[model samples]
Target: MGPLLDDARARGRTVVALSEYGITRVSRPVDINRALRRAGLLEVHTQDGMEYLDPGASRAFAVADHQLAHVYVRRAEDLAATRAALDGLPGLAELLDDEGKKAHGLDHPRAGELVAVAEPDAWFTYYYWLHDDRAPDFARLVDIHRKPGYDPAELFLDPVDPYVRVKAATALARKKLGMRYRMAVVPLDPSPVRGSHGRLPDRDEDGPVLICSRPDTVPGRVAATDVKSLLLRLAGLDGS
Candidate 1:
């Protein structure tokens, strides 16, 4: 990597290093959907002893994403009640309504009716089932699209499952043999997830970063939204 950078420098090419966001250590996993379900706002359907979220039939539900969640309410009248239901929920730092969404630039039509932000050292989970035995088949597997929310637990193997590694190896062998396989090794527990990011960083050092080889084209500080314009400027395509 150093040699490549040196070669680029020798060729008079500009280099830029950037990151979308920085992850911070987290210990708490906020069961946001479970909270909504406990309040009777979220609904689920049972199939073969497994529970799956029924968004269409539900009054309200939460889509957890890292340290934040988007709460979708089916009815306008349920908005206040939904907010009240989330009150005192552990690790929930803030709940954003219409005014709050507008202030945060999250008032788009596609945005959820309410946005939930987790505490600094916490993250939101999509687990809606009250019991592990009733969890959906995909809960123990890394099925990103089917989960209905971002799951950091997908990064780990089931720590309590003694045969998790063996099953994973078997799945890999089956895949290599061009056979159907299910890599159901991911954990249902979110406690092992030690890092997450989504909420605004309390300090600048904890946020995203941008570094440019051409000092003249770089600003003293850069916001995440300004990165694109800065890149265009660096590429001499912005007519700046």
Candidate 2:
């Protein structure tokens, strides 16, 4: 990539490099769905001894993603009750309602009724089951689509399982032989995850970065949303 960038610069081609956000260190994992379930707002269904979230039947449930979560309330009447139930939850920073969502530019039809932000040192987890034994089969595997929310724990092998590596190797071998395999080696614990993003960075140095090949073409600061227009202008396609 470095050589390619140098080559592009030598060729006088305009280049723009950017990132969505920077990850920060996080230690606290907030069990948002568990809290809602305990509050009688979240509902789950049992299938073959494993519990899965039933969003349709649930009065309220949270879809956690890194340091943020969207709390979907089934009915407007249950909004106050759901909000009250989440009160005093540890690692929670703030709850965004209608006005708050508008202020944050999150007021969309698909967005949840309530949005939750976590503290600087904390993050939200997708774990809902109280016990590991009753967890869904996909909970231990790297099955992203099956899970309701983002799970950084999928990046790691289960450290608690002594034979996790062996099992993973075996699963790969089985797949190579054209046999059915389930790579159920991901850990249920979220403590191993040390970094996450999604919340606004407290420091500018910890935020996203944008680098332009031609320094004169870009301002000293760039807004996240303005990147598209800036790129278009740089490419001479914005009708400047």
Candidate 3:
């Protein structure tokens, strides 16, 4: 179990598991406009205008890749602690290739190569890509589910039901929120959202999916150049 799970169990409180993206985002909202400075548990650094992870604070998350994802504790002080962790996290660059090689038994060579350019360990938990190491491992998911105050029923989503579809959508929503894809608990009991692929005539599927939350989360797919500009300029990439 993670630190948060242990803490929740020790305190005899139900872990507010993030069963979907919406629940996780609300629990750890991502303020896109805010640049990460200091992470509560991790020491983040920048050199030559490039951000890097302080290996001291991050534990190599086990996945197909060795340095697949990072495991860090969420701070009780601020929800933005996660945001700070996300923004300051090291992007996949070869700066630490030698150090990364020290780890064995991961598909990092193959999978890492694909994602190391755009996102490294930082994007592992956020998006479904090469580094999504924390995703369900049938072997280990039970310990995670059986923890105190956890409801195992949240694991499965019924495809035909809209309520379950919303739970499934939670995965995407959580990614947009930039929280490590963990467990979530929906506030209401089965108030499902539509799982319709029905596209709006005006909104092309190629366009960025626009989700209106408190700050209106937007995830659009554009050219690499456009993505870079948005991350670097609009999102304060240098600062992060």
Candidate 4:
């Protein structure tokens, strides 16, 4: 693989390297939605064998993933009470306000009004209900749809169920990136591994091909594109 990449670079092809996020060993898991529910800011219900939050009645709630959680408040009038409830909660580092949102490049419509950053030693969990039994079967079966946020646990292959190799591939294909990107779920044939999720398929596969809108931004290659864009945007010189 290294030799192939080197040959590509020698041929004047560019490359870029990036990751979705970093991982760490968490000492404990913090369920922010549980805290909100206990404070009477959020509501949970089990209907149709599924446990989910009642978004209409909730004042504030968090959609959590590994180390980050996006908290959405239903009413602006209840923001103060919601903050008071969430204040000093365990595993919560800081809540991002408007300034903090802008500092973190998260001041966008899709982002939540308040973002929760977890402590380095603690990770966020998407468990809203206290009892696991009351939750849906998918909750324990490595599902991505029932949970509001991302779940890295779905990367693993279930030993009991060999058919569903890529657990989260179905959900990620439907809900992630709003279908802007293509997803490929491949099985590890002749290998010890079961399957992999969210990967680009091999060139031989058939279907609509995924094309990059900006082909200039290549991997394994470093350029001033990011820095220049940031500087120009900050200086009000970039149109966007």
Candidate 5:
């Protein structure tokens, strides 16, 4: 917890947020209107003008047109907008900060950074659609989705790993000009062991992905992903 927070703080972020809020906050609403669309691994949308979805976000939930879904917040302007929308809640900032320290640890760089700029509130609501296995079932993506007339219902969805994307987000915010935040989750594969010059440590209060320093994350493993890659991929630079 201490190290991960140290890492995040060293870089900077608002707080270590879980992809859970960004992904599944309001996805599985008690009311869902299925049969909206198909064939989209990702569905991007806007709710009250906020970016709502990106790659790995679900389409089965008909997120393409749903006003309830959410998307990853990348840019500072966008993040600021989000923080604004979340106003009205009291102590959200402190709670997040204390929780952050508790979550990331007292000395994580990422946590330190997040505490520096964290707000007192984060809008909360119901969105269950975000939790429907954001991670792809490699087998299904390769076999079932490729097969003719694959049944969406029959297709096996990989369990959601909200931390992977959130961790990446924290890392990206770290490289930002001034975003202090940390993310709590089980670190992604291709651990920093081989990438970060061996800064690998154990779990923190944030649920694994303990911060340390700039990860020397290897080029491949899925867990090795960071915000730079995720954002660039969103910008259509995956092939590069």
Candidate 6:
């Protein structure tokens, strides 16, 4: 890294690096979904010992992962009830309304009407029901497809290492190969663009599968390079 930086400096190229917001130690984990359920704003459908959101019956529901939650009200009439229910909650640090969203540039069509943020001492989880057995199938695994929310826990190694654990287990099952493999985590930016929330684009713009090829065969595959080139090709922008 030092040598590369030095070479870049010699070549008269400027390099800048920045980081996202920092994190602090968390003491408690808040389940915004559970809160909404308790408030009678969210409804669940149970089938075969699993639970899923009953969007038809729900007045409001929360999609939470990490410290942030986006609360959506199915009907406009339930907005006040949702706000009043979450107000003065212990772990909640802030609840951003329409005014706050406008101030924060989060009032876009894709943005939720209400955003619930947890305190630094607490983080948010996606659990809507209390019982572990009742959790949705996606909750028990590293399934990103079924869960319609963000999951900051996927970035860490603790509690669950979705990528590594799955790969290791797969490798152990096929040990006859006696080979090592790598994994590349390509992040498809899910940040909502105005008027594009919850709706798929007419064509592949920037959204694609979360994976490319297996690590061993990635050297000359479609996504051989970094994530940027891979994503570009996936979007049919790079003229693959």
Please report the candidate that would top lDDT against the real structure.
Answer: 2
lDDT of each: 0.92, 0.93, 0.30, 0.62, 0.30, 0.62
Better of 1 and 3 by lDDT: 1
The superposed Cα distance between candidate 6 and the true structure at residue 195, in angstroms, equals 32
The TM-score of predicted model 3 comes to 0.17
TM-score of each: 0.98, 0.97, 0.17, 0.62, 0.19, 0.64
- Per-residue alpha-carbon lDDT of model 1 for 171-236, expressed as tens digits? 999999999999998888888999999999998888888888988778688877788998998888
For 141-183, candidate 5 gives per-residue lDDT tens digits of: 3233322121222222223454556665666688585766433
Model 6, span 1-240: residue lDDT tens: 899878966876544332222334455656777778898888988988998988678898887756677888987898999998888777788899999878755687966779877775666666677676586656644567766566554454332335756765665556556766333232222121111111112333322333332234234423212556654554468975
Q: Which wins on lDDT, candidate 2 or candidate 4?
A: 2
Candidate 1 lDDT for residue 222: 83
Tell me the tens digit of each residue's lDDT in model 4 across 1-240: 799777966876544333432334456567788888888998877787667778887888888856678889988887787788879989788788879889877788978778888776666667677665566555644456767776554554544555554544665766665765322232211122222222122222311222222354433232333645643543457996
Off by over 4 Å in 4: 48-50, 155-240
Better-scoring candidate (TM-score), 4 or 5? 4
Query: Which portions of model 2 miss their true places by more than 4 Å?
Result: none
What does each candidate score in C-alpha RMSD?
Answer: 0.9, 1.1, 21.8, 11.5, 20.5, 13.3
- The candidate that achieves the highest TM-score relative to the unseen native structure: 1
TM-score-superior candidate, 1 or 5: 1
Which model is ahead, 5 or 6, in terms of TM-score? 6
- Candidate 1: Cα lDDT at 40: 93
Model 3: lDDT to the true structure? 0.30
- Writing each residue's lDDT as its tens digit, candidate 3 over 1-240 gives 688667866876433221111111111111111122232333334544433344354322111122133222233343344433444434332212324434422234332211121121111211111222322232122233322112222344543445645654776688789966633332212123212111111344423332322123234433333444544543345674
True lDDT of residue 59, candidate 3? 23
